[model samples]
Target: MLRLHDSAQGRVVDVVPRVEGRFSMYVCGPTVDNVPHIGHGRFTLAWDVLRRWLTFGGLDVTYVSNVTDIDDKIIAAAARAGRPEVEVAAEYEAMWWEAMAGLGVLRPDHAPHATAYIGQMVAMIEVLLAAGHAYRIDDGVYFDTSSVPDYGLLAGQPLDSLRAGTRVEPNDQKRSPLDFALWKAAKPDEPRWDAPFGAGRPGWHTECVAMSLELLGENFDLHSGGQDLKFPHHENERAQAVALGKGFSRYWVHNGWVEVEGVKMSSSLNNFTSLTDLLARADQRAYRLLLLRAHYRAPIEVTPETVADAERALERLDAVARRFRLEPLDESIPVRRSDHPEIEAAGDDVRAFVAAVDDDLDTPRAVALLYDLATKANALADGGDTEAGHAAAHLLAVLAGSLGLFLRGTDATLDAASSALASARDEARRRGDFAEADRLRDELVTLGFVVEDTAAGTRIRRA
Candidate 1:
């Protein structure tokens, strides 16, 4: 079984499934108003890793992440461009998927769009109104935070404290500063849906509550998002479920933020770095490796230096794969220690890796264990123990694949010019001409190849 840090509990706890041998999870998806940033990339990768690990453990996982096609941000962007809101949402949503595919994130089992669930959201709001959990002001229907006793449970604060810290808005008719709109009245020339309350659109927080309950049902196994959503967003989602006398998520998981120079990277702060730009310049796998090398709950600083370091680490893994002629492991297939003789032979290391990952998805520690396995495999191969080296390499590939890092046995075919440069560099080293050897190695690097020295000879691969 896996354990995770549940935001509602404020500590790590066992993730006991609602049903035997099955896991259901709902992660908040992008708003689709602009290009995704590093923060978006981090959250999506964190949950994707968890989902892959759960499946690798032989559990049936149903993942649902919703897209917010209708939001204030979408409307604002549309207005600025003099385009329809739907067109803007559709364009950005396509870019969102393109970026996710570049990062190798698997599509969710169900991606419920907010526009498609308007009827359900309206019905839910009507139920809340009839139950006195919501009230209608001139602007729109608002959820009364006072209706729920534990309104701030996800925020980990008392109601009084939250109210004190909240900034006052222009809606003076709101009963409390903490009260949030369930539906916002449509402004002139804005998109509107016909509701009994008025012609309006759903609030940013209402769509998730409606979609999750509809797709995963009550008390789904886990609800996850970035730490920023822990506040009024997730808390408000939970309150709606509680007010309706229904169960919400059994566990709440939030990944930490992406920080640049100690400040959180976010579009609102104008400090965000685009995910597309990073992918365009660096190897996409390097970003995933960078995320895995750090604890998911700790802030990560992503710069060219960090990405370059990850790329070098990836080169080492690929080198081991090439030396052993290892093939990529398919993570969709369930892995068991008893099924593979190599896994059983490498029992101690495999067990350590599992232990690290099982404890709240501690990927940093697990990644260190992987590097250790790679080193042991390479040393065994160099010591004339071919069989033992192959077994260790097999173990390394399987374990790394479970975390979604696939090692390739071969890179792009080395061109004739680059190959000759590598051979000449090896000859220079053999002749003890250090300066010439360094110069040739730099030349190969400039040709977009990573040059490495091995017991056999110089090994070159694409950078």
Candidate 2:
């Protein structure tokens, strides 16, 4: 059994142990209009860590994320790029998958594309309309927020207040300002599909509700996304699900936004940083650490210095990973309840971290716990107790697997760096520059290599 922080209740709820231990989870994935940015990466990494811990805790986890291939933004982006909508969406979606895989995120069990589920979305909207939960506007279909009594519950906004604060372009067709679109009418030269209402496309919120229900049933385990999604997006999703007479998502999980120097990273502000840009400049593992440093709910203020710090920390962790004999740990170790106290404590910390995650996806606390474990294990290794060292090492391996951090293998780039260092040393030695050789060896250590001199030969290992 594990305690999960419930975003809906704003409290921790203990999930009862089931024989099958199946846990269904979903994260609101990207609208495949453009390549993802650092903000997008931060959310993905945070959830990847959470999923790792859940798997660590011995849950039969089935994770799903959606690819929103059809949206106003996607159409606009396609037009802006002078490409077909399908071509643009596919290109960006392919990039999203490649970038995520390179960043070491485990591919979700299911990745349903919105375009593929047009029939389901249309059917779902039809159900809502028949139930008196939606209304057809002039040229489009709009969800009637007034029909749902608890319209803004998830957003913590009352009905009238929500309507007042909400911004819908001064439109006379909408029954209320808070009412969001369910289907948008097709425009000239835009992608369109035949629907009962008209030839149109799915609204942004409609796909998730339809996809989640179709994939995970009316009720599922978890729903996660960026903090910005809580209002309008998630809130609208909840109302849609409720209107469809389904339980929707059980737990609402949200990771906080990435801030730059204390301001939210926004396209409007021109403060957004693309994922490709960051990956180009730094190692992927370093980028993960930068995100893991903060609680998921706490806004992270990223700068060049902070990213550099993350890169250095990753080097240290990579050194530790390289020292280990790469092997899968014994299946005997229970991810949730282990015989050893240390193991149990580690599991507890994970539970607490995720419970905080359950609270609102408190990723920073989970990150802190990870660093604590890494520090303790490293300290134990430093003490020269090889048995404890092995155990600690094993723990780190488990944590890495569970949290999707510290991939314990040789990256080709790192290997090339080692080869270059060796070549540099060899050149220095051939020049009879003993002083230069020593300096090069020292430099290799800073680059995460371990070097030792012996009577017969010199040995090198990743530091």
Candidate 3:
């Protein structure tokens, strides 16, 4: 059985699925008001690693992540940009997907946008209000935290401790400081949805409650997001579930924060560097490698020195791939250990990788094992232990693929922008516009793409 750290249980526990022979997971997604940052990518890759591992292990998985398309942040950005809220959301959501694709993250099976589920959210709000779990105020409706006895289960604290830490709100109408909004009454020129209480929009906490239950049914297998959401955002979601007497997520998992320099990354810090900018300056795969180097729940710092180190480490892996002529492991291939007969002789390496990965996705140790296996593969081959050498190399590729690291057949990884430029330059060349083609190649070079023209076409990589 896979064991994971449960934020609600406050410990690593065996994963007992709500149903037999299946897996269900719900991860919180972006708000889509602005371009995603490295912090966003970190959370994204962390969950993507988990989803890939589950599927790689041959379990049928259903992944659901929600896009908060109509949040306060989106409304604010729309107002500032003088555009419709929906238009602002559509623009940034496009930016989000382009970034995710560049990082090779898989799309969720179901992406429930907040705007599409306003009706469901309103229905849930009605249930909460009918059961006396929520109350209306001058500005909006708020969830009464005291109604749920175990309100702080996912917060890793008792109700009193959770209440004590709440930032005092100027809205004194709230029953407790720990209480949160269920619906926000429309402000002037803000998007509004009609509800029994009034015309207002659903709160951030309510969307997941409705979408997860509707899509995954009650008592879904896992609910995960960044550690920052565990406190109020997720806690409020769980509270509503309990108040209405519904079975919620079985296990709660939250990844640690992404740090910049020595400090934690946050928009308030004015340091949410756009993921687009970071991908432009560095290899996209290097960021993925850097993420794999640390434990998912451990806070990781993103710095030039650290990223450069990760890039060098990837070069070592690529060198082995080039020497052995190894092909990239197909991600869709089954990850059964027995399928690879070569690894049967390399049992120790296989066992070591599985042992580390089984323990809360201990990727740091698992990645170290791959490095050690690659070294052994090269040395054994040079020493005439051909059978053992090839086995080690085969196991190394499989293990990295299991962790969603595709090491073979890669030049420098390219961002969406550079890749598009490479395509456009090819079209320019085909039209016999040599000047424009040269200009495009120069642009790619300035963005760190190694532009090469061949008899086939221009090849570009942004490592």
Candidate 4:
């Protein structure tokens, strides 16, 4: 069994699946109003690591992350650009997926879009209204937060305390400041959907409730997102389910924020870093390694220095791969350690890695364990323990692959020009031509390869 920090409970708890041998999870996805930033990348990677680890442990997992195609941000962006909201949403949504692909995030099994599920959201609002848990005002229908007894469960604050702390909105029609809009009345020149209550759009909080219930059903295994959503967004989602007397997510998980200079990265703050720009400058795999080095529930700083450090660490893993002539692990296929002879031989280290991950997805510790194993494998090979070294390298590859960080061995597909340089370099070394070997090494480096001297002669990989 795995454990995770459930935000609602305000502590780490066991993540017992609602069904045996399977898991169902929902994560709030991008609003698609603009390009994704480092914060978005961190949350997606955090959840992707969890999903991959569960699959590696032989559990069938269904992951649903919804896109908020219709939102205040999308509407504003469309109005400013003088385009249809749909067009604006579509453009940004494409960019969102492209960024995810660059970071190697697995696509959600069911990516429910807000526009496609408007009918369901309207239906849910109607039920809430009929049950006296919602009321229509001039602006739109509002969910009466007072109706839900434990409304602040996810926020971990009492209803009275939340009301006292919440800033009063100018909309005096609302019964309380805590009451959020369930549906927003359409304004002039804005997209509208005909509803019995009025012509309007669904509130941002309503979409996830409707889609998660429709797709994952009641009491799904987990509902996760960035820590920022734990407030009114996720709390409101839970409140609606409570009002309807439906079992919502069994566990609420939230990852920590991506920060810069100790401030949370956000577009509003204007301190955000573009995910696209980061990928362009560094190895894409370095971001995944960087996230893994920090606990999911801890803030991570994304500076040029940190990213470069991760890239250097990856070279260490690749160096071990080259030393043992290891092949890259294919992640499309599921690998079980019990089925692999090499992994079975290194049982202690494998068990340690699994134990670290199972305990609240302790990826930082798990990452350290892998680095230690990489060092051990290199040392063993240097000591002429060839068989021991191979087994250790195999273990490192499999463990890292399970976390979606695939290691590269030798570059067999180097272009002819690069291959010729490598061959020449090896020849120069064999003839005791130190100056010639040095010249050849510098030439390969200039050609964008990290050249290394190995027992099997010179090995080179892309920089």
Q: Which candidate number would show the highest lDDT if scored against the true structure?
A: 4
Q: Candidate 4: global Cα-lDDT?
A: 0.91
RMSD of 3: 7.7
Q: lDDT of all predictions, in order shown? A: 0.89, 0.75, 0.86, 0.91
Query: Number of clashes in every candidate structure?
Result: 0, 11, 0, 0
- What ranking of all candidate models by TM-score puts the best one first? 4, 1, 3, 2
- Give, for candidate 1, the lowest lDDT window spanning 10 residues: 330-339
Which residue pairs clash within candidate 1? none
Tens digit per residue, CA lDDT, model 3, 91-172: 9999999999878788899999998999998998998999999999998999999999887888778899876766776477
Model 3, poorest ten-residue lDDT window?
331-340
Candidate 4: count the clashes: 0
True-vs-predicted CA distance for residue 41, candidate 4, Å: 0.4
Worst 10-residue lDDT window for candidate 4 reads 331-340
lDDT of 2 by residue, 1-463 (tens): 4555566777667654223577888899998877788888988888887776677666778889999998888888888989898999999999998889767777888999999999998998898889888899876899999988887777787899876776667588778888888998887787899998999888899898888888888678889898889888999999998887888787887777889888899655778888888888887777777777676677888777899998887766655555554455443222442323465545655566556544434555665665676676668767877556656566665554455665444444557667777777877777889899899898888888777553323446664
**TM-score for predicted model 1 compared with the true structure:** 0.92
Off by over 4 Å in 3: 331-345, 409-463
TM-score of every candidate: 0.92, 0.84, 0.87, 0.97
lDDT of 1 by residue, 141-211 (tens): 99999999998898888899988887877478999988999999988999999999999999989999999
Clash count in backbone of candidate 2: 11
Our model 1 lands, by Cα RMSD against the true structure, at 3.0
